[model samples]
Target: MSKIYVLDTNVLLQDPYSIFSFEDNEVVIPAVVLEEVDSKKRYMDEIGRNARHVSRLIDGLRASGKLHEKIPLDNGGTIRIELNHRSFHELQDIFVEKTNDNRILAVAKNLHLEEETKEKGKRVILVSKDALVRVKADAIGLEAEDFLNDRVVEMDSLYTGFLEVYIPLDMLSRFYEKGELFLSDISKLPFYPNQFLIMKDVMGSSASAIGIVDKTKVKVKKMTFNQEHVWGIHPRNVQQTMAIELLLRKDIPLVTLIGKAGTGKTLLALAAGLMQTEDFHEYKKLLVARPIVPVGKDLGFLPGEKQEKLRPWMQPIFDNLEYLFNTKKPGELDAILAGMGSIEVEALTYIRGRSLPKQFIIIDEAQNLTKHEVKTIITRVGEDSKIVLMGDPEQIDHPYLDAYNNGLTYVVEKFKNEVVSGHVKLMKGERSGLARLAADLL
Candidate 1:
């Protein structure tokens, strides 16, 4: 018995081809959904762009037949636009306001009632990413589900990509002597690709060791980089670990880092990039750039060149660079940057129509981007170019995004399964002890 899945507008906006994701099930799009999609199609951001895509997809479907009449999709789902299911009386009690959501809920209720009458015994569920909508749907005795298809993983099951397990002193000695130990040697050890392990002596005799496992192939002694301690930052936290993994790993080509504020995601990436690009010379240049978003308020325009216009957003990166370079005067770092010119910090608006090759690219504050925007950034990568996208998913300041549906979350979730990608949830704040306490408490 195929179930009927009524999609909310957000699901389609988040994913233009969400109709095909159901796979052989009956997909219902309330007439209100089309109206919402039409309203959003004219905007320029990801939502608006996705709205246009959904419009094109629906138009392509119409070439086969009318959407109100069942149209078979390529992925074995039948899509139907339901314009006739609206009734004000069904939802007038709780949702007195005639919002689009209320109208869609009315359609879902009617569809559920019809299934009950027909004795099909099939499940009818309303899927939405909005918490209030889900609550309202369940309040009316209709089944409701959050649009969790875009989540990276369940709350507790999010990929950590590494783990530290305690072992007995004797076991640690045996492991050091043998050079390798089977996973079964430890009863409860969770690990992922390129994960590091710290073996502390159980009885504490200043005997400890650290090693990294290369996806279960070989375990090698963990070589400490001077840069790790140069900045006085610890990589034990998950975000730092993720940043180090992306910056240090030579095999993986794509890496994305996401977390809230004070996670040290950007600092870690910059430090690691400097190590790989300048110290190691792994790439031709260490290109650092981020979209020139304003801080607090946009100061209209500046009187000088493009560099002047970008000073506000790029200043944070420069501040980090100044700290790394240990510059005495404020303008000294600028002179150094002018001399190298290799590290470019132009706005993302200009990167279009350009191909970057043999460079380590870092895009910061990426949560403000849309899926299309992120795709545009990724597609610009040339041969041998490695791009690292780091941003705080929870601190998204984008107008149309929430915690779960932001472009950053979408990228992290969608790309987690690929061999070239990895992700981790950085729960601790490493900027400062006070910052960490504020991040945790506030």
Candidate 2:
């Protein structure tokens, strides 16, 4: 039986190509959704770009026939714009306001009623990203579901970039003596490239060894720089050690770090970038950036120059830089940045359309970015450049993103098997005990 899917405004804004994801079902677009999308097309952010893209897609669909009538889609599905059923006679008493959500609900409810009378075994479902809208849909006796097309993996089963395997005590000793172990010598479980491994004794002994899968995916090799400190910051745990190994490698150009608050994701990336750019002179410049998503109520706007205006959003980056540089005075850090002429800290908004070569780039708080936005940032990387994306997926600030669908997680899952990309999910919070407690409890 073919079902009817009514898309909400947020679903289209989240992914413009979502109209074609319903397979062979009928896709219904309430007229009010177009109005909502139109209002967002004027902004210069990702939302505006997506809204405009949606408009272009719907406009192009008119070649078949009128959008109000049923238009055949390429995926054996049909799409139509719901013009009538805006009357809130069914929900006026339950929902007094004539808001856009209420109107969308009215259309969905009326469609359900019409389909039920026909007895065609057709189901009418409301698809939305907003939680409250789903709740309201339930109140009005309409089936609702979240848009799950973009989710890379479930939150509980997300890849942690580390694995534990039990081996014989003799094999562990052999790995320690040779400084490497082949995957054929271990269990038959699959291992991704650059994935960290903790080999333990199967007989419950105290001996253990840690190694990383080589690019060939056949051998588990010891970390190259596990003992060395980068920018005066040492790895506090096994996960951090794995992260540093990936960050310091020149062959792996793309690295992703995911963790909770104070897990040293940003700090490790900054340290490795500095070590590679300043200490080794391997890169021409060290560029750090992050998305500008406010946590709580936005502070409206500030009055200042471009850098000064970005101070509030970029302060977290500066804090890590200060600790690495150990600047005691107020203006010392600014003077150091000015004198170096090789370090750059800016917002992610200005990174588009620029070709960056021979540079060490760090994208902090990358979980706030959409998949499209992250792709834009990564595609700008020129030759001989490394880009590190680090963030806490559990603490997303973007209204349209979550732990499973955010860009950080997306990159982690997509690039896990590649030789030039590595990922590590830091498990321990090394900032302080208080911060760790807060991250766990709150």
Candidate 3:
């Protein structure tokens, strides 16, 4: 029997194409969801864009058949807008509020009761992205679940960009002597381009070496930039070394770095960008941008000009830059930035339609971005531009995204096979001892 999936407003807002995800099942959208989506359609953000997209999609579907009735979808499923069974009497005792969420729950509850009476094995599940909504649904004796179609990988098994492989002690010496090792001669497991390998001694010795899979994918080569310092910053750990290798490689246009707080993700990315832009003159400029997602309570309506208003949000970027520049005086870094005119720090909001060519773009805090938002940013890269997306997936601030489905993880999984992209997940925190302890324990 086909199940019934009643979607909440947040599900559609998170993904406009969620209606087509249920295969051969009935997708029912409460009328209140439309009202909720409509109220957010005018905002200039990702949610508004998704809300408008959902509205357009539902309107297009209506051309095929009446939405109030069963409208057949292309995936052998049916979608309908529930206009009836939204009476609050059924949920008045349980939920006294007549809010939109309550109305949606009432629709789902009525459908579930009706299905229970008529069909034998049919289930009505409320699909939402909100945790509180799921809890309320369970409180009212309804089956509720999160929308799991957007997740690219399980959080526990997320890609770390490197693997530990044991090899014979002789092979480790041979790799050192020859400066490269054929992957076929080592492990039989499949490896992606630019993935790091820690070749340990099979005899349980302390002898080990690090190598990265080359773009050819046939062999693992030594890291070219492992010994080089970028903007006076050196790699503190093996993961940072691998990240530096990818960051300095001009061939790899897309690089992603994932780690916890104080893992030097932003610091390393800024160092490489500065070195490539100011020292090597590889690119025309260094463009640093990040999504403006506030942590905890937001300080609404910052009072200042554009740059001043952006300072609070971009202070972290400036802190790393100051450390790299060793600026001791007030406004010294600002003077340098103004004198060079080659570095641009802006929010990801203004980067939508601009064509960035011959530039090194670093998008910090990328874990707060959605898949579509990241795609839009990547597609804006012009010729000779290398874009690096780095963030701690565990520290996401976006309401609808999680570690498994954020833009950073999504890009890491999707481009792991492509030769033009590389990824590294830094494990150790190098900011300070206390910071590391907090990251691990707290």
Which one is best on lDDT?
Answer: 3
Model 3 lDDT at residue 96: 81
Cα lDDT tens digits for candidate 2, 1-442: 8999999999999999999999999999999999999999998998999999999999999999999999999999999999987778988889999999889999999999888898565899999999999999998899999999978997598888889999999999899899999899897999999899999999998999899999899999888884568888988998988899889999999999988889998889999888888889999999999999998999998999999999999999999899999999998999999999999999999998999999999999999999999999999999999999999888898989998999988898889999999988898899999999999999
Cα displacement (angstroms), candidate 3, residue 169, comes to: 0.8
| Per-prediction TM-score | 0.80, 0.98, 0.98
Predicted candidate 3 versus true structure: per-residue lDDT over 1-442, tens digit per residue: 7899999999999999999999999999999999999999998999999999999999999788999999999999999999998878889998888988888999999988888797485899999999999999999999999999989997598878999999999999999999999999998999999999999999999999999998888999888884558888988889999999899999999999999999999999999999899989999999999999999999899998999999999999999999999999999999999999999999998998899999999999999999999999999999999999998888989889999989989999999999999999999999999999999998
Off by over 4 Å in 2: none
* Residue ranges of candidate 3 with Cα displaced over 4 Å: 119-121, 226-228
The sequence of per-residue lDDT tens digits that candidate 1 reaches over residues 57-111 is 8888888888898898888879899988798787787788999999989999988
Relative to the true structure, how large is the alpha-carbon lDDT of every model? Answer: 0.75, 0.93, 0.93
Where model 1 places Cα greater than 4 Å from the true spot, the runs are 74-77, 92-96, 112-124, 139-141, 174-191, 202-206, 215-220, 224-260, 275-282, 291-309, 327-332, 367-376, 398-427
User: How well does model 3 score by local distance difference test?
Assistant: 0.93
Please list the Cα RMSD from the true structure of every candidate, rounded to 1 decimal place: 4.2, 1.1, 1.1
